[model samples]
Target: MNFLTKSYLAYSHGEKTVSPWVILKPLGWLGSVIVGTRRAFYDHGVYASEEPPLPVISVGNLTTGGTNKTPFVEFIAEQLSRWGLKPGIVSRGYGGTTSEPVVVLNGRGDRSVVGDEPLLLSSRLTDVPVAVSSDRMADVAALLDHDVDIAVADDAFQHRRMVRDVDIVLVDATCPFGNGTSLPNGILRELPGSLSRAHAVVISKSDQTSPEALRRLKERISHWVPQERIFYSRLADPLWERWDGERFVPVGKNMTAFSLTVFSAIGNPHSFRNTVLKSGAAILHEFEFKDHHHYDANDLQKIEDAARKSGGKAICCTEKDIFNLPRGYVPRVPLYVPRISALVEEPGRFWNVVVQALRPQIVVASNGYGEDAIGARLARKAAQRFPQAEVCAFPLVGSGIPYKKIGVRILPPLSKSPTGGIIKYHLRDLYQEIKAGLFRQISRQLSAWNQLRSSCRTVLCVGDAYLLCHTLWGQGKKALMVATAKTKFISGHWKLESFLYRKGCRKVWTRDEETAVELRQNGVAAVFEGNPIMDLSCD
Candidate 1:
């Protein structure tokens, strides 16, 4: 819908609520079925999920608009940056017409191309990168650079494909939960019980509630979640800073005494109205456009006419609305903006919830080109599933260009084939290996294996059984064996190498069921799973 109609707003607010809610319940149920089906697609891996190169913390709420999702996203970015990490934002730019990903705020153009939230984020957050695209799953990675430590996905709780490491769901403290229905009938986009998908829950606007009410709110959320996962926050210190074309001047008693014209295009205009009244500003006239409204010459002229009619001396608005205001068209009366910041009582605890989930890294090690491709594929999967853990690669042979392309940390001692994969030149390559000191290369390979052993919590050996033997050097270490090159029926030389598989790596995945049965008969813990390399190949 282009706008929230009066009937829907009345229904959402629980005024004249019943008959309309009953009429709309079937549609809400339909919304629930669709949402559930999508969630099931991701859960069962029917539709694939993609994770960014780094961890992602999503800021979203069940209710449609009033939760202040944008401001909370800013709060997360600031907090993540404070923890000595470079953070960026990926927003599904709702109002912009562009389909391609655009960097709206990085010391360049304004909000018109990237939508209001991104432009607002860029303006408020200096030196941070913000990318806007319709398909956040496919485009979020472009927003992040090699230096970005983590990413914040704005309004992405329902975006199942763009898998996030930390899902932080915000609840408006007044209602605590939704009006017990899904979209159209009420405010919730997903079912209320879906809050279980969140790793942490923040009850926003908590300051508005009394101490006893706040305690009850947390307890209520705990009914669906553990108490430790719940946190509280509010929009504190609402202040107006008057912009006189150049600098910001503080709004004071004298400023409020003058009759004022208010203009806002935020999701919750009532909150802005309350903040304006709190500033003691006398409202001469008020104009609220749709959320994220793009203003033009006509909108500006209407504001001028309204101010003239109401005899208001100045025009006031929220900081978000300033992004969409027409360029070089300052009204006759000055425009003042109300600035509100997200406040949390325990920021440290909230950050801890996010970081703890990202701990303990995964490492993939392989022997050759085929193995390296398989290792790179598994590393990306691990990175997506375990957002807190760093997934790295230690290539035993070859240049490891494939791992590098996927953003895997390619460990050194870069090796290459003498004839670049021409088996006809085997004699020349054998001579090259001898000339380069094959014994020294072996020693270095052993050292690299030790480094992998020290760095990773779990080791995945992709290609050769020699790596499995070398990687199992230390006790009390976890490892998985992928027999990518092995067949069910093999020569004596292959069977001799198969003995190393019995050295007790975790479950081994073989290329086919018969290979798994043979490995098991030979006293190795093996199972038939499809090859990882096939998933990586374009063919």
Candidate 2:
């Protein structure tokens, strides 16, 4: 290892001895403040989160890098796919020239436009599509358009803006918590305290650690996440693709004793090196590039020189690095890649978490014209977005004539309001209507759903959100209340009668940014999704 690399690694693992790397400590403190402040902004509803159209699972880490994110990401995606879900990946595309989010894989496109990590995923996942861009929301939205059932974000532990159904955090078992500091000073991206928000914690590369090490890690992780939410995983036995004489062959065993030069451009090269050694390869030479480094002709030439210098028989690389290599540019010596599989320790339990998140089908309760329209639109689109799911809809007003026209399954309405909840315009009618036991009828219907709650998943309240009575009052499997029409059209915001109703909502998506912004200004976690009415048109 280089001097700086060694020093940084030592510092990251809690070494306090003063060194040149210590100069950056103050900067780390500054970064902590900024990161904390931004998170506080999200927590306080200053900046609201937008939920992806499909159910999303986020895979990330507390440390800045070297958590073996891709392998675990692959693990989660594959497991989800095995359960008959069409899962897609959304990545930041760390190293690439592209600005807009684009589909990297579907048997079309190359590395230059798609970025390396996305291309890596494309090659690994035969059943799923991979989209890459810095704009996560755009990429996710596009993925939903491709009929993706579930969305997985590669590294989004701190991405509060994109609300996820489940946050699957990967803690490197080798170094579960890094020096317990934030950035520059250490490897931590967020303080350990923040892990409390994670839905599950995964201990990656557990194969390299001792049982005692894993026990200690679990003890610490249990403080943040429940023991049931913790999972263990490791990279499985590797299939080495090597050039055997004239033709390239995949090396399964026995060839590991042969001397080879290893190279990689991933977050955790040390972990990669250790895995290579464990595979029984006699290390001849090693080249470590910065994470996500784009390889070139000169780099390949240098690797060849290293192989010749060490008298190595072959050059080995990671499966992730294969995409960046020039197409059809076969080298003189064998260019082999270790095709590793991400194997979860307990597959049944890990898959159960994903299946549970996918179970919550929407129950739209539209109380008015605009709301009924939006609800029907979303109901149809929901079916399209989650075709594997059995979606249920409940129009809370006007006989659900529009829903009937569109072949949507409508739940029993709560109560019929003659004034249609426009009490200001028809107060006398509203009074007479309420006096005739409208509240009682509504109570009876909410009770019916509450009883059969096992049959359905969420309570989707559309229209004037405040008008939603007992439907969102207490019956909470999962609930979403959306504002279909802009509040600007109806003057100021509604008084929010059941102010406590906001607490019951799993999520609240608004039709426009202005309305959502105002809602957040008043401390409501309302997400702005561009006109769901238009979004459903594609469905």
Candidate 3:
């Protein structure tokens, strides 16, 4: 299911109040094992290709969509061609019917078979070769047979099956990693550190960002992939072209002017809409589709109806969407196409890293605690250590020992608290809102956790009172969940501590003077620790 649907279900059902870690723990391990096995195969050359024909540049992002990868790929292709090199574009042809490499000669051809992106590219750049295939490796091989010099692989950053000479990772200027968690949990495809494999980083849609924001983004990226070069790129609107089936017409403000508005099924629809709005045209109506949504007769009919109702002069759309238009659909409406090109600055540094990687073989080497998780003293220590990291100390974990167990919350913005002060507790009346608040908190925490994992090498998680630490441990992060004697002193919620122990947290730092002795008697590794606040003050 999509993220929104899953979120709605979790919120409506009050599932967030119950610990998801309990259910996700086993499945997470299974996923880890599967991932590990897959990595081993790729590392062992089990999936390696023999005598790969030409250099492949894979452009992709960790999240599902939002990053403008297509335009980035187009930018690279255009650059290569300008440098007097032949470039062939290959895509997975998402939502397309064909599995074989289908060459799209023009936009008039079967969009369903070749997909919108390839068809669009084919129409815009007739000289460039564009092909679509589910199996990229086969497509690349086929391109090689046709004497293609280099292959530009779209959205192939996670496709480790084929070796790429240069990996360009793109991040959306805004919402780089939504809710920062992996799929079903958040939006990440793999873990965050995955960007370390990228030869260069491109912050797409740089126009929307300020200089300071861009710098901060660069710093964050540098923290994870310190060695990789970074560049800023923005989308530029070329001359608006309208296709009337027989010929292409280029028009400016002088021509018979009409307000142009657009909606698209592309990953980042907002960008498409904003581009149209930026153009000196009136936006009468807009309709968005799910990413890679295949258009049907009904969809087209609805769009036509909307256009007719708007009574606006022209219907503008993204080239990607235009490629998906049903046969004879464009003729029905005065279709205006605004061409998008990537305006890249500081290409020298970005391309230099790519060239350097090509010269030699690139070798890539690649949270939680709970209360005992929270106490005034523990909070003081955390504040000292992680002044920037948001601290969330709550009673939701149900750990019997309040002082010893504390939960650290990350990514605070996603959660929303009620506006008014606490009302006399009414469980039934506040049920839905409480449940929604909890889900939002968990969602934000998950996003923050994923973002932290992606950006940091080591994260310290205190308090084993909650199962959140268990969730972190499951994801293969180095996490230390501490539980003190004060934490065990509490009763009903303290039962949750057992869940943390079950999830493989080796060290439980106890606040009790005799914690080591007591844990040894119970066959748990418990070390006695002096007050954490003292350490914080000294540092």
**Model 2 stretches with alpha carbons more than 4 Å out:** 13-17, 106-108, 243-248, 326-329, 361-539
lDDT of 3 by residue, 466-539 (tens): 34343342233323445532444544223345544433344556666565455555555557676553453343
Q: Using alpha carbons, what is the TM-score of model 1?
A: 0.67
What lDDT score belongs to each candidate, Candidate 1 first? 0.72, 0.72, 0.60
Q: TM-score for model 3?
A: 0.60
lDDT against true structure, model 2:
0.72
Prediction RMSDs, each to the true structure? 14.6, 9.5, 18.9
- Candidate 3 stretches with Cα past 4 Å from truth are 1-37, 44-51, 106-109, 245-247, 253-258, 360-539
Best by TM-score: 2
Instruction: Identify the superior model by lDDT, candidate 2 or candidate 3.
Output: 2
Provide the TM-score for each candidate, comma-separated.
0.67, 0.69, 0.60
- Model 1 misplaced stretches (Cα beyond 4 Å): 1-4, 18-22, 176-178, 244-258, 360-539
* Model 1 / residue 492 / CA error / Å: 20
For residues 1-539, could you state the per-residue lDDT of candidate 2 as single tens digits?
Answer: 36777678778667655667778788889988988988765543345344567777888999977787887788778877777888999988777767788886643566777777787777678667888877887889989777898899989878777767777888998877667777878888888877776767889899899999899989988987789878998888787777433333666755556788988877677788887888888878988876767788888898988998898878888777766666655777777777777777777897676567546556667777666777787777778887766666666555777687878877664456676655555678778768867777666666665543323444567766543544543333335777654464556466563243354455667767787777777666678876666665455
